[model samples]
Structures are given as structure tokens and as C-alpha cells.
Target: MSTVTTRTVAYPADGLTMIGHLALPAGDDRRPAVLVGPEGPGLNDFQRGRAESLAELGYVALAFDINGGRWFTDPGEMLARVTPLLADPDRMRDIGHAALDVLLAEPRTDPDRIAAVGYGTGGAIALELGRDGVDLRAIGTVNALTTGRPGEAARIRCPVWAGVGSEDPIMPPAQREAFTAEIEAAGVDWRLVVYGGALHAFHHPPVDQAVVPGVGYHPRHARRAWRDVVDLLDECVPVPG
Candidate 1:
């Protein structure tokens, strides 16, 4: 079994409590750290599972919640809940920046080697954080709706890997193509994976509700995305001393 710790971190004077799950490498040493952002406003079991899996791979990982403890079971409900927060990019950056501060303060985390991975909406936030000049080493996002933010792409300092499904409507081909071009223009090392016949939330293994008639889960893409996440971390975040 992997070792893990659940902690509550308060954002800087924001009066909102963010829940985080930290998974430590076996036998203890300051290790490279990853902040795994959940897809919804709050976190879910799949996000926690990713953290545990990362710990199994010998990196310190933290799965964080954007909203304080509330989560929506349905997609519509989730959109209604996070719409306001999503509209405000500055607030979104604050949320990520605060989390980075907390992670940097962790004694067991290697401040020099920090990266972030996010799924769906959370991936959008990770992109914002990366684009806002947060000192990340690597960034990996899965099934995200790519949006434009001013000066965001130019500020990214690390390698980026983005995954998208060919069948996902939320992230259409045109949008991903445009986003890829923007990323390339920023002069940052980046890779884009277009998975065949998969839908949104491909990395969320336990998500059972089908958003459409015939598309839901793709285990192959999910597993491959997990491996890609690991590879990105290994490339960007060095093992702690």
C-alpha cells in the first residue's frame, strides 16, 4: 500500500479552505512534488487515486480541491457552481498561486522540482497557473477546454504536455489546434497527444456517467495518460535530495 496524508490548507486570507491529499515516497526523503488539480470545483476519488499512484512511483504528490468541500455529482450542477470562478481568471490564478505557496512550504517537498497536472476544468486552471509565470518545472493537462488568457502562454517557463480526445466535443479539433499553435509560439517545449475515439475526462478512471450516448471511458487512453504524466514529472521535476 502507498503512504498518504490528508491535509487542509487555507488559501492566503481568502477564508476558503482547500483540501489536499499528500502522498509521500516510500522510506521518506525530500522528493519531487506534483500538485494534481481535480476536474471539478472539489476533488474526487480518482484525483486521490492519482496522488497515490504517484507516490507508488516514488514522487511526492498532492491532489487539491478548488472549492472548499463541495462537489457536484452532475455535470450541469458542476458548471453552474464553477461558472463564476471560471469567469474570473485572476481569481483562478490566485487559487493556484496559493496552492503553490503551500506546497513550497512543505518540508518534504523539493521546491526546485515542482510540477502540476490537471484534468478537464482543472487542466484549464493548471494552464493558467503555468502561463502566469508560476515557477513550475513541467505541466501536464488532460481533456481540457483550452482558453486564451492575456500574457499567459508567454509566461510559461517549463515543458508542457497536453492530452485531448478526438471525440471530445468540449475540446474540439479547431480549439486544440489553435491552442497548440499558441503554445508553440511561446517557445516552450510542449507536446500534444490526440487520442483516437476517446471522450472527455479520459484520465478519470472511475467516472461512470456517460456524457453522451456512446462515449464514456477509455481505459487505454486513461492508462497511457497516467504514464505520460509520470514521464513528464520525471523529465521536469528531479528527485529530491
Candidate 2:
């Protein structure tokens, strides 16, 4: 196995310091990069692990903290910070663009092969990044709904893959159908995988019910989801020469 290294990078965003955890292969080859956005507010352990896993797969992965260390589960705080960003398309675009720039500037990363992955709230940001013409090789989202004006799907330029739980109440069957129709209408390549008997937050196995109040995971789906993500990365962001 190739050596792996993890580091903390501080990048400027909105005049504030945004801390990100970056993982990369230790060789001289400039590998493709993946930018991971967190689910709710700030950086978490799960996102960090994702970066490490990506690095192990021969890619330079940066897990960006969009919330700038601020997180709130309470309805009021959620509305004040997360909801507004979700409602406004421009804010999400700016945040994603800034982080993409930071990752692109990394010497060990391949800018052209970059991709984005997010969970829940972070997933929505990833969707917006693709919708805003990031030129990403591919985009992956876990348990996120359509965001930033319904018709924004027409702006996507890369293949998109979404993983959702069949039992997730928030992402009901009807909602999934609407999301699919819009993406299909946009003429972008997209796929939605619904894991049977799984609830929200299925990717993080150990964290199924610990972090989020209502989410419990399905072990089988979690394993399969990880494989699917790795396969997507392998296909879209091949190792550099």
C-alpha cells in the first residue's frame, strides 16, 4: 500500500478562516482530488475518514468545512445558518467554489479530475456545485434533496450519483421521483440508488444513530454504498500518469 498523509489547511473564505482536513497519497504523482462537504455545519470525524479513504484509493482528498466550525441542530439555529444557504443558490455556489479553488491549488492534486461528495446538508452543496458548472468529473451525494430552485438541474455539467434510503421519511418516494425527472430533463447523466431497508445516514455505519437523532443505518447498504462510491471515483477520477 502507498503511504498516506493527512494535514490541516486553513483557507480564506468570506473573510474568515475555513479549516479543512486534506489527505493525499505520498508519492510524486499528482493525483485527482475530491472535495468533501459535511452534512450539517462543521467538519466531523466521518468526513475526515472519507478523505483518508479517498487518499488510500490514490487520490488527494480534501474535506472542507463549509460551516466554519459553527453547527446547530436546533431548529432555530438550523434555519438561521443552514436553511438560508439551502434556500439561496448563490451562497452555496460561492462556498463550493472557494473550496474547489483551495483544493485545485494543492500541488499534489489534479485539478481536471476533481470531484465532490457530500452528506445530507453537504450533499445539497455538492449538488449545487455540479449545477453551477464545476466541470467536475462526477458528483456524489448521500441523503440530500433537490436544492436552489427546482430548475437549477439544467445547469449540471457532470454525471451525478445520489444514494438514498428507501425508508428515509425526509426523502420520500415522490420527492425522489421529482428529483429524477428534473435531472433527466436537464440531459445530464445521473443515477439514484435506493438502498432497501435502510434509513438516512447509512454510509456511516458506526454513526448511524449517534450523530443524528432520527437516522439508523443498514449494514448491508452501508457496505454497498462505500463500494459504489469507490467505484465511481475509480471510473471518473483515474490515477494520474
* Model 2 regions lying over 4 Å from their true place: 14-16, 71-80, 205-213
lDDT of 2 at 46: 71
List model 1 lDDT by residue over 39-65, tens digit each.
864687777778888877767788777
Per-candidate clash tally: 0, 0
Question: Tens digits of per-residue lDDT for model 2 on 148-222?
Answer: 566678888888889999998878899799888889988989889999988877776553222554577678898
lDDT of 1: 0.77
lDDT of every model, 2 decimals: 0.77, 0.80
